[model samples]
Target: MSSSKLARMAHVCVLALAALSWGAKTVTYDFNVTWVTANPDGLLERKVVGINGQWPLPVIEVDKGDRLVVNVHNGLGDRGCSIHFHGMFQNGTNEMDGPSMVTQCPILPGSSMTYNFTVNQNGTYWYHCHTDYCYPDGYRQALIVHDSDAYFAHDYDEEFTITVSDWYHELVEDLSTEFMSLYNPTGAEPIPSSFLLNDTINTSIPVKPNSTYLFRLINHGAFVGQYFYIEDHSFEIVEIDGVYTEPTEADMLYISVAQRYAILLKTKDTIDKNYAIVTVADSTLLDKIPSDLQLNNTNWLEYNKNAPHPQAIVNVSDSTDLHPYDDLSLVPYDHMPLLPEPDLEINVTVYMKNLMTGYNYAFLNNITYTAPKVPTLYTVMSSGDLADNPEIYGDFTHSVVLNHNDVVQLVLNNGDTGSHPFHLHGHQFQVIDRSPPYGPGFYDYLNGDPVPYDPNNHTAFPRTPARRDTVVLPPHGYFVIRFVADNPGVWVFHCHIDWHLSSGLAMLMIEAPRQIQERVTIPQEHYDVCRAAGVAFEGNAAANTKDFLDLSGQRSQPGWIPDGFTVHGIVALAFSVLSAICGILSIVIYGMADVKNKQDSVVPLDNPNEVVVEQNATGQTKT
Candidate 1:
């Protein structure tokens, strides 16, 4: 090829590539949250919340750094709804966070709200309703953000997601009634009638021989942790939550509630043989149902159904009898233990007992948490009372107010008999340390103050800790995590198990309340939803207090007008800021549109060595 021809080809390729990647900006999604009754596991039928009328909701996929705008219209008959983006760090847009009673008000019945945030991190994630105890229903769905810099980048042929869960037949309302009643006051959670994968008992996945595939496993269950394994296939895990990890080869993995794992699967040369992709409820920590009630959920991995296979091909087992590793013990790829020197440390010991409520309630920091009448976010921002006097903030809600950009080290010790899967919203925390299962371990527990344990203990600190959003706290074991409170919001750090969260195993992280107030403008739509919820609860007088706290008559301050500022003056100033923001956004959008519309004449690729060749591309030969 001549020099001029080669130069022209390169120029054309760049132009075409630029054209193809144009207009790839933030995505906006409109979702309808409606109550759709369906049987997902074929065990029983009941009303379950569905997104866009689809059971198990729908998978939301995006790229890293894309601004996500999701508008949700709640159509549940008498309940409120809030969709918490499970692993997203809402950063500056704290009001857009959806944790009810923690961040913002829930979208009331027949109401709509918009969640806008930038997906700055990437990997397997999920979203679900955070209001009430309806998380066990079919409301949760997978949310995946693709990152180009993900570990094991060039090793995979294709990628897919698998969601596994325990299925219940009764609605949350009915279950809560029995669960909290005197008959079952010890709060023995209802055993699942079945287990499911992607809303089905058995899901099918097609595979090609000798190819590398990425399988992202999302454990979206509300109660039980799941054990996952593929028959005769060993895989390498590269990512957990939203952070990539050093590749760890394993045969089986333990996936707890609200957790995710990304692994690379290499297919064997056997073509016509089918393999089992099995997921069972971790029987060690959950109620065991009969073997016939669809307990062991499974999927299939095979190459071709039509082609006949030789007898030499190995067979797979349908029995769920594999031992899964403790995933909390894994390490991150960039493992350096000394990275997180915390500015503040908080120690909590999880305990469950029959408390103020008739049911068995879980506690953290010796406080059985309860949602306040006003949202912690609203309470902190509107009045700045929590910031001015944080001493008054220490109530049943168990709040830990942090300064702006404060590095925090949180230690959790599970004092309960059962294991708990804990998850934190708005941040992916670096896991620094954990205690051994049942032995004389590193931490000197005998010499310490129990219950509200001592936080200043340097006991088995890691140099290169694994970072994830959700972590498992083994029974009588401890786990420590470090995170920086850079994002200002009322974030929820709670046990991911629905029963525990509903039973008050949660704490509020009031991060930089004053900074959040200064940065985020409280939208009028949020105020509308708050008013509507109170009104709906008052009129019917039948809705549970846990659903929405009654905010009638006990008025603290009227209107959010600041001192020395008139209502009209505040409105005028707000409108001016809104107008400026709209103008800037319009300019940005128009500029992007103009770039997309720009026409460029391109010289064709007329010779060999000019075509773009990728490893997976077809029609390859020596020219």
Candidate 2:
């Protein structure tokens, strides 16, 4: 055998022995969440969420089968916060899967909560604030799960994690006021002020010649999806969103918000020159691009310190011109076959419409997601046999109860004129079909009505489809995904865009509530924080313990606008018309009075057409 093959075998053996030596252990972190100043893009400095008095929060690293615990204390004193491990299948520890008002209440100012769970799955994932409008202010970081038994672990010498995000100059709270206001009728997302690479710009990552490196790429931005490429280099895709996929060669990748990709890159043999790593923001997603806002950023892969590092030369007129390899073409490494005919199929259409308040809001089949008084998981735990009833979770939440171990097929049609990255909380799903595939034809339906999926008339589904936790739904197109409801938890399916999510583009999946109750238990710390935040831990959606069906005081979205003029609209129109008439009448009266006064003062001459004015003191003929 060749020496290279022997070396690879030796490496694999070493990793296997290391894995045996380092068994599962508990990893704990004490985080004091506070505000700190940072200027990642070098243009503006602003307050950002920091852990333990540091910005660019630490990346959490752990091995498979290890128990991870994080104790969080909210010290911002104004904002509530919670951390959601992005792609974890929390399994029996459903309460540890964090999402404000979905599984647990937000950790309010001065309150504390602990997230404790085991990491059974291995690949790339992240952790970020799940509270409403909280993560954009630098509250996110990458979470890596190291696996010695991975299919391609022996192929790389070292690994690196790089995060790309769209940074904003203003805080999310300030931006949200204008984002959800009547002034923003079209629900246009706030444009990012700058794009960041590893939370900073113009940096270098050192590398050696002729070495293989595993680069894990994460798009932790709030709104924009970015196209990533290494100039003059090609990488092999190995994993996506915590699911290991068979190696596929690609030169460029488009990563949407909250999505991840791991690629293996082999460096060139010579170290004379350095190369640029480029990330270009998707201009199609931006409503308006600012001249000062740089759409593309360049970082370097340094081969030698003495070599001249240069900026990347972009060759495309637009980001869309750079066609990335289609992720749907990938096949999983394990080759999990396509699931059987779904036991339940959910069909929902995305819509953006103006409510009675004149503000645009997102909806799924005419239902905007509204949070219940009690956390949905709490409602499920407290309610006994009625937990199986979806009605108990309230209408506004758009709750759907799933049976244990049932195959669920979800068909999402985009009626709106924008792309949305939909993410499921607890499970990675197989993407079966998508319309207008990811190349030049992605925007084919932008000018027309949405195309809903017709089960009988569509492209053939893949036998072993690619699995991912987040999938992007195209503009006015549709996507179909399926997964088995094996994990019993209150998972959320929502758009990853913070603006869209805050506008009610989300829904709840109450999977196996009976099993959830039997297997999961809420810690006292969770209850304490909920009580401190004035949230109910028991009862139905409306906090009515007496009657699970009573939803009289439940919170709801703003009322919808009628087809034509509404009552308030009619009253305002009449008031405006009356005011205009009175102003016009006053102007006419003033003009007539002035003319009558002039007639009274003028002296008439013998000719009817002529008139005389007052004579001067000198008494000359004044006519």
Top model number, lDDT: 2
The candidate scoring highest on TM-score is 2
lDDT of 2 by residue, 1-623 (tens): 99999999999999997786578889999999999999998899999999999999999999999999999999999989999999999999989988999899999999999999999999999999999999999999999999999999999999999999999999999999999875677788999999999999998999999999999999999999999999899999999999999999999999999999999999999989999999999998998988898998899999987899999999889887878888999999999999999999999999988787777889999999999999999999999999999999998999999999999999999998899999999999999999978888888898898898999999999999999999999999999999999999999999999899989999999999999999999999999999999999999999999999999899999887777875446446656777899999999999999999999877656898766555777986555
Task: Give candidate 1's root-mean-square deviation (CA, Å).
Answer: 27.3
TM-score of 1: 0.77
Q: What is the C-alpha RMSD of each candidate to the true structure, in Å?
A: 27.3, 9.8
Name the regions of candidate 1 deviating beyond 4 angstroms: 1-24, 306-322, 334-337, 385-388, 392-394, 437-459, 535-623
Task: Return the TM-score for each candidate structure.
Answer: 0.77, 0.89
Clashing residue pairs for model 1: 246-333, 335-464, 336-463, 336-464, 337-462, 337-463, 337-464
Over 1-623, each residue of candidate 1 has an lDDT whose tens digit, in order, gives 99999999999999997785554467888888888889877667888888887776778988886778898998887788898888888877777778886666778879888887777777899888899787787888899998777668788999999998888878778888888654554568878777888888655788999999999899888888877788789999898887788888888887889999999999998776777786766665555556576545567776776653222222234223445665555687767464557899888889876532234677886687777656766666645433544433435677788888888989898776677888888888887766643222322342343332344654665666778999877666688888988888778899988988988889888888788778877677877888877732111011223322333323221122346654345445656777999999999999987876663323346785586443435656532
